[model samples]
Target: MHFDLVDLRLFIQIAESPSMTQGARKAFMSPAAASARIKNLEESLASRLLYRDSRGVELTPAGQLFLQHARVIMRQVDYMKNEFTEYGAEASGHIRIFANTTAATEFLPEILAGFLAQRPGVTVDLQERLSRDIVRGVMDGSTDIGIIAGPIKADGLQVIHFSTDQLIVITPLEHPLAQRKKIKLTETLSYPHIGLHEGTTLLRFLNEQVALSGQTLNMRIQVYSFEAMCRMVEAGVGLAIIPESSARRHQQTMGLKIIELDEPWRVRERSILVRDLEALPAVIRALISIFLTHDSARERRS
Candidate 1:
């Protein structure tokens, strides 16, 4: 009987966090109290909610179903709040968006700012996540829109063409590979490389491709941001493979060379994904229109 929005919020936190105790801390509840509340919630709903394992917890089938409804309820609650606030001030609503590092690093910021500038009423909450996680967020109704690198599986969502980003190799001006117009990845296997962190999509792709080809990529240093990797490359530490957009910016002033990667995977075809394009809020739909139109124009010009 004590279950309410607080319980739902805690439940979502628990689902996302590594452990229930961590979720409890995030929700500002004692672990024992959080456990008791979840038990009460399960009993009230007449179903088991979570499967506990040594590593962490996972949702049961019923928990997964409940999570979808919970996210919708929470999003609607936020919308209602934003609605009243906007009604009082005649402002646009907030939209939640997720994207991969490629989009977040090289694409979304300036375009989102321009779009928001044109429509002062709308506010946005953008987050960087892996493509698969972004897809999951859209499918679960937790995110309004997602931009991701494609040729991906998106089972119950609408996908729209965004942009195709070419990948390039970045190297210091003195590096041997810098002089090459286009070079195969295998040609660089002998040199030390600057790599992105382990879980990043591009890094994983590079690792998988190298492993598949029976080549070992010697990662001398790993960095979290493309900018940092570029800086390291400029310092003559090692070379990196990054999106052309990222490499071009660094090339302008960093004295770095951008070599076009001569591989089929050099092109990262990206797309915008949504759970229900027609059901999007008016402001969000308008924002999407602006973004996609601009991107398409750029693509055409290129």
Candidate 2:
């Protein structure tokens, strides 16, 4: 029962992408060919791999099991290629990262710039995902490292402190609650709000708060960037719950009010999650070491 690594790679792509067809397209193959390759793989293994529906493809239990092995095989192949090219290439390998919207938007750019500057030969492939999904990607071996906002249950994961962030309400200076120093999130629910695009980590967290308090949020506008959301709030469109770090940056420029949230969950702590610290690739370890050093320096300065 032999299968092509290309097919395995295609299957991994399909498992990660929105659909089987998109995965095929990514592999530079047609949809029919992708399906046939997956079918052959399943037939060879004598197990169903994916569950397809209107939404998209999801890994079945068997598929999840298969992914673990496939990732190991792929990593081994990558390692061999890099080893062979070590003399020709100074330092080069791909690092896959899964980070939530907060880490992706807030502090990653600065940290990543520093990392890449020092390791010019390394390339990074980063994808933004919800915190929980980020954990899943790390646990499933889809990504080498994951930066998640706030605390989450990532069973079988090695967790370490990455950073601290928080969600705060941003309002026009003249808004009703602008005078208040701090307020419960539920108190602001009645007012029309400006929210980030759906599916973002901050937006999802806010929605969960709304759901828990049994209050509906009047989200007037959904914008892409934190700065855009602040601009909308400044225009008297509505208020928004945004990261304090971002909001603080726009405070003077946008003339917006940053109101601390009364809820304990408002202050978020970011953590790095990995499957096995010892097993991390050398490049990944180097990257993590730099981040840790930076965080320590900030701590000392603060």
Candidate 3:
């Protein structure tokens, strides 16, 4: 029937206080204005809502029924206001994020833990995929944010350089190459390698490096996951190139030896991807800030 929110608010105040003067005071309006609002609301509903006599104003049968609906609408409006208010402060709502396997398993855990500690009301749903898939997810509206190793070419996504990760060459502790201080590209290819599948960014980067050094990587196994690569290296199956963070994450249990790749292929930048900078919700922005500032500080300390 198109009753105004102002009239609904006045009706609620009058219903609660049962006194038009008190309702007017609570609403910061004159008694005449409050009565007129109540009158308009009753007219909109085509019913007589209140009857005033010796004992404060009393609701008619229709007024009592409509009051129930009015209370529900008021509560819903209040909840909406609170939700938006908390959203602005990064204190509420859900965030959908996509990350590569390395970031999902190795890096994002601690960062997400810290973010949740600060903003418990905000929930994050993270999905792990290949770096290329992560970029596609961000572009296709499947995810609110993404983290991946760069050379990202997605035109629709906004990329931010968040942190740098070094790829380390790993081998079984007993492997003869484990003792090396720095492994050259040529030396690396001399050993059979356990590597990621063909389409992954890591594999692409390694292939580029191998081509640049005028050698072909003697890839022995093509696995889909880094954890699998680590297990294979631990079993002395073959050596693999993986991020230093992933190496450290499994260091103790895997008992694998890790060596820094020599000059040419040392570090890779981990970039944050967003669909639109302006469209990012406050909680996601706060999380990005947390990752940037906290990871930078942790990197400096190390």
Candidate 4:
């Protein structure tokens, strides 16, 4: 009935990664050893932790509960280590972030690069997720920070507003939709649309909208990035809906036309969600400040 930090950490890693083997690699252990350790841990706790399948693994109800506490325990351990080494070492810690598609793809890459450049000891694990899922991740302590957009409620969490951007439609210059300055979601659903990949947040949101209108989106192709989506649109594959920031950037070089979305939900505020910002580690707070600073610079320019 006894387990140590290694067992806890291994379980957490397996729970986060795509496969036990991948998690083992991150933990600097062999897959066989990792499997054995997990088995022993389950036996000691008298409960199953993961559901295994060909696709990789999923957390069982018990496993999800375990992960919640495991993350909190690991964070506290990190805090203790940092306090002990305050005099001898520079600020150092790992920050786990969950962000919606717009923030993750449009904004974070350059911003994170600058943050990392200045803080050599800090590392980040970033994932793109739906806004609701990001809220859940923050509530469960599984994520250190979440950058979410849209009308998702963060009732109990501390929210910090950052950037405001809208979803804009892009089409080939010769496309019929390009002749208009603005278009509605309903107008675009009938046309062949270039979508982001299957599991992306924006695609899911678009699907929900199409469902409400009693029609289906004609998703001709799915690409992995904003640039790819724009490229497909430029090639006359289909229309695309992307963040204004990304659309503007790609439109400058591609033969794509930007059309404003005539929907209220099109404009969304991107914000930071955290359980308690001040309770976070110093390294994490510094990164948050960087986001705020970047937003301020954008504000001044606008």
Model 2, span 115-168: residue lDDT tens: 788766788998999888898888877788999878789988999886787788
Candidate number with the higher TM-score (2 or 4): 2
RMSD of each: 4.1, 4.1, 16.4, 4.4
lDDT per residue (tens digit) for residues 1-302 in model 1 = 45699999999999888889999999999989998989999999999999987888899999999899888788767766665664332257888889888877666888887777766777888898877799899889889889888577999899988677788898899998878998999988899999988878888788888998898889999998988998999999999999987887777778799888999888888888987776665666776777778877986876
What is the RMSD, in Å, between candidate 2 and the native fold over all Cα? 4.1
Q: Tens digit of lDDT per residue, candidate 3, span 128-147? A: 77777787767655567889
Better by lDDT, candidate 4 or 2: 4
Worst 10 residues of 4 by lDDT: 82-91
**Candidate 4 lDDT (Cα, 0 to 1):** 0.87
Residue 237, candidate 3: Cα error in Å is 2.4
Q: Assess every candidate by TM-score.
A: 0.79, 0.81, 0.60, 0.80
Candidate 4, 186-283: lDDT as tens digits? 99987999999988889998899889989999989998899999999999999999999898888889999999999988998888999888778777
Clashing pairs in model 1?
92-121
lDDT of each: 0.84, 0.84, 0.80, 0.87
Backbone collisions counted per model: 1, 0, 0, 0
Comparing 1 with 4 on lDDT, the higher-scoring candidate is 4
